[model samples]
Target: MENFIYKITPSKLNGTVNVSGAKNSALRLLAASILTDRDVTLENNPNELLDVKIHVEMLEALGKNISIEADRILIKDESFNNELVWNKRSIRNTVLIAGALFARSGYASVPLPGGCQLGDRKIDIHLDIFEKFGAKINFETGETNDTLMLTKETELVGQDIHLPIRSTGATENSILIGSLAKGTTRIFNPHVRPEVLDLLDLVSKMGAKVEVFGQDYIQITGIGGQSTPITPIVHEVVPDNVEAITWLMMAIVNKSKMEIKNFPYAHLVVPMQFLLEGNSGISFDEASQTLSVDGKNATSFEIATGPYPGINSDMHPIFAAYGTFAMSNSVVTELRFFDRFQYLEEMAKLGANIVQDKNTITISGNIKVKSETVRATDLRGGMAVLMLLNEGTDTATITEAFQIERGYNNFVTKFNALGGKLEKVFPESTKEINVTKEALVA
Candidate 1:
């Protein structure tokens, strides 16, 4: 099968969705596990997602002994050879592995990382910080690919480093390398994402001296300490604010009531405000980490994506889907990922009046969609298309759903459990070329 179709029925959606662990945070934490000489265990980690699973596979391939039980993972960094280079397939997790390798071996050579096509994610900040800690870097860039060679001279000497931006990857790299430096290392303009803090906590647990002074400054005292085996501790992962926003938008689009459990309300302040501006009634229960949505009279709204504590670029695609059902026009300005508007073409096929200008998208209200085939350009785009299929259209076929499977574990099974009619089909069987013109004439 070349494509999969979702046969959806418009009905009231009820029940609780227990949010999964933070994929972003778990990936970094898994990298931190390699810093310990003894066995380290991580709880509430995202081991189910394909990205995380592949990272785990890479770790195992590099000769790390690991085991998983429930939401906890036990990783023993008994023996690892930094000489075991990573291929293109293994480079996807380079951001996390870079920090881990630097912490353990005092040197690392990671090829340029790969991720969604969100623009140029340069490594200048990472390299600058690494250099400040007495590491020299060599770059090998070609027409289609690049690799990095990092080496340390003597013990890394810590120094105060300032970053041009609050890049999460840069901050993580600094923390990982700085922890092993000889003196005090101070990082200014640091990113304060919860995921970064989680990594700091993990490093501190491994006997590293770390302190956060303010919003964008962190100080770490470098002093090598003994490594001890630590087992996984059970700590519930924070709910995905992006996914919660997607579900909330779904409720608003359908003008139906929805109660989202295990939602990280604090992390969704911006999205909540956006919903409020649309006149969608919302209530949150902090104790239960649940968000209730009542959109009987939902209106339209406008938003622009920003960094943390703002409308995230990651949520822009789903916002497009929800905007289609608004009572009035809605605009989503993607300030972060400039090329994200391409997915609107798929929405257009579903009869959504979406117009794109550079990084902005204007969505007309109340699109009457018809069943059609669409292709997911990326992970978030796939989810956006899936949400659009929830209503409006009778049957929508989606291609390149493998991108969605990379981030969402057993997505079809989960959607089916929620009464969503979706079937996965192979690409070859469902997609055909060169037959459309002849078939159309017939």
Candidate 2:
């Protein structure tokens, strides 16, 4: 409920947990599903996130036969409309859909993308790359939302394009369209985040030819020049690297003995380096694939968020929370999203001495949270408070729990499995907490 608040008391979490399917990967895969006329089943995809639901609702609006059986999403064969009719006015994935729609139907009308508003994730690169492939791009402001129409009267032929930045979104959009476009499309300076690799694998399984050059170049050969039919696919999403990192943070911040199973170590090579930062309490079991930590002491850390393989921009708020209890100073420079550190202000409510010197966040001193209530401004920012709550010496209330729910699947249950004592309080309910609260105690 909108009026509900989460009361999370400080506790230690210890258990093995599986990260949900990559939301980023699933969003792009959902968009890529439109490139096919055959049934597309995505295994391990979570259907509950608000962004995913919004994208699915948009697909259903365009006559996509979508159904869910447990964690697998069955998208039956259906004719897609030429117009990009989205239920939500804006989602960052819309730019992605525009690319897929243009390739599949030769026309796409999408509202300017909006989702997880950290900063201006510009679509200029998207439009520029599409234009390189001879797409006719136009912008018109509408009453409800400003629409970006990408119409290709002729077939989309592959082109070699160099991206100034290795953007995951831009790369995904390019790959989606390029997979269906006539001829070969070569993307230079592409982001090869594990999630992007997952998309490449998904498309390759669905009949496209993709080649990776080290890490930055992705060469895609379209499926028989748009004449070939898309083969139906059954693909599992890549494990969420961020979620794995969250559990790692949980291990350190809570300072509890914990085992995090299904930890994606390969994708986290760069991030893991920073998190470890010569810390002795955490160790990895390569054979068993577990990250275990005993919270005997806090490890000092400093990091700067960049593109993929670098620390993710989304991790800034989370690590900021972890920085609170570190034995020494931790500095984070968020290069991707300018406004990402805004959540740090809220964490200060818990007595985190986080100071922003321009884009870099300087966090000093170990803190015991005195925060009673705080707001979750954005998706990841919202989760930051929960990390802060885990450090609460007393009970703390985190408002806007929906933001966390949007991205995370079974948030409370997973945390509870790790020994977290959290409860949802509904102001509108006649009872303090709904009957569902009994499930925890039971």
Candidate 3:
């Protein structure tokens, strides 16, 4: 297992930090590539991310020929095995892969999805979507309900699916399956975020007709069984808005004036406006897609997580850390994932006065955080703990630090560039060898 040892010595940070391509966008975009047999190229892909690596492994298992160079990935369908029958780490995006596989091949058998342990993050909705698309689903007979098998006895035909809530994964699966299914598919109440739009852009380029009527609904015209295969084209992924906000929060808490390059301003208009309301001196350069942070301290405020154009649940922990630095009180409610309060207990070790009642959490701020060992329960929560390591000189250990790497590309390198004293420690090593900050810098 990997852990991060942080020696806090807060100092003024300088330099331009380049943001990587969006992890959420890249993962699904890779899955959408499985919808066609033609070659596809993805530029600006975050190939260094752990999640992206796992996704690549999954793609290879499906017999896709993938070549990665720098941040670009070229995928070619070679000998695709529709049945993903193997054992390895799995991500929630497997559901999307399943949808794509079902679209291309009439059957798919995949391992269950696994990612952050957010409560009630089930794929039942996804299964329902598959059923609506006329696929018969059942748990693999030999597996311990850890694998899902989907078989389409007849041709896949699209249907009108009205999602109960705005679900990003469900919406993405609908788009992927509908890309090649017969007839036009209509999806209602879809979560229209930058990542979803990124998938839409790629599928549309592949010859799927996708129409978005505001946030109300999306319609896709499938070209299944067409003589011409889905067009082979190159697509560039959008910048990661989550990583953009991570850098922004790092600037705010460390009181460092820095520039975050490749910042996706348009995708974060709502959240950026909200941060500006809290007295953050952040400026965006549209031409350069960079964010200039004046290193002003963030003020206490309240926010609720919702679908895009609103603060997302992934931003909850980052915002919680921002609130911890404010002199006043702040409250954050997790409207999407109710049991995402696992990070609150970990943040409390850093001297944050946070009290949780159901989905709402109240944080009292301005208290100096002490260096203490904590756990990175999830991706964003782990980064939040790192953001709070501003006051202590003692080493703070964050166990399962790999969680942080699963999302952010070269995060340790980026943080060290911003004057953060962080190092990764491998516990199995005889000498407790650390991937030193100097090594990363060099």
lDDT of 1 by residue, 5-76 (tens): 344444455445555667777777777766666577777666677667767876786678889876677887
What is the C-alpha lDDT profile of model 3 across 342-399, one tens digit per residue?
8888888989899898999998988688788888878888888878865555767787
| Model 3 lDDT-worst window of ten | 433-442
- TM-score of model 1 vs. true structure: 0.87
Best by lDDT: 3
- Candidate models: Cα lDDT each: 0.69, 0.78, 0.83
Clashing residue pairs in candidate 1 (N, C-alpha, C atoms within 3 angstroms) = 1-426, 1-427, 2-426, 2-427, 2-430
TM-score-based ranking, best first?
A: 3, 2, 1
TM-score of each: 0.87, 0.91, 0.93
**Candidate 2 on 91-186: residue-level lDDT in tens?**
678888888888887888887677665655667899998888778999986654567898786667888889898788888888998888778999
Higher-ranked by TM-score: 1 or 2: 2
